[model samples]
Target: MPHCVILYTPNIEPKTDLGALCRKLADTMLTVRDEAGKQVFPTGGVRVLAYPAAHYAVADGKGDYAFVYLNVRMGAGRSAAVQKAAGDRLMEVAKEHFAPIFEQAPIGITLQIDESPGQVYDGKHSSLHPLFNK
Candidate 1:
């Protein structure tokens, strides 16, 4: 599987429809294809989870928020060039999809490739998490 993880805390508006936003983001990520005409995303296996911040103290806090986590698994045999291309494409799509919401937030923003299990040139592995493992 592709050995990269992109994790970001999208600064959403307080009390926004996070479920809808998550669905949209997931859809955008799932459909990305590489230049070789190969499907770069997992086979109906991308996972998106929305969790409210643990620091949420006030029930009526105007800045209440959730975390959007996206996980993708790709074939381990794919070339490094293909993997990088795919990852770059996915991030680009994500930024475009979430641009409007992010622009309105107080904090600027950060998108990170939090976990990369393989070498930048070549490697192989799979990722299983609490949400998708089930």
Candidate 2:
């Protein structure tokens, strides 16, 4: 599951489109391919969800500041290069999406990729995978 969870500041919601950003992120995830050029992440398990923090405090509560923390979680099995590529691509897309707002407002964006190390317990129950496999 390459689930992208976007935690952004509420202030930016008015200046940007979080829903469109999520869709773009999901699209970027699908473009991440392995060495053989096969998709690195399964299509059906991809998820991009954004949640604006109901309340948050920036580094200093001086001015109206905003931030977007994007974390991409996936099952481990790929090389570091692949992970880096995905993170780089995702960050690039996110940065481009928020460029306009960044020019007029003080906002920050952070992206991280967390690959499972085979220790975490993951339960599976999804009918969507079958559709994609076909």
Judge candidate 2 against the unseen true structure and give its global Cα lDDT, from 0 to 1. Answer: 0.91
All candidates: TM-score: 0.49, 0.97
lDDT (Cα, tens digit) per residue for candidate 2, span 1-116:
77999998899988988899999999989989988898988999999999989989997899999999999998889899899999999999999999999799899899999988
What is candidate 1's lDDT per residue for 81-108, written digit by digit as tens? 7667656765676566666666564333
Give all candidate RMSDs, comma-separated: 7.8, 0.9
Report lDDT (Cα) of residue 78, candidate 2.
89
The parts of candidate 1 lying over 4 Å away from their true place are 1-16, 56-75, 113-134
Give the range of the ten consecutive residues with the poorest summed lDDT in model 2: 115-124
Pick the TM-score winner: 2
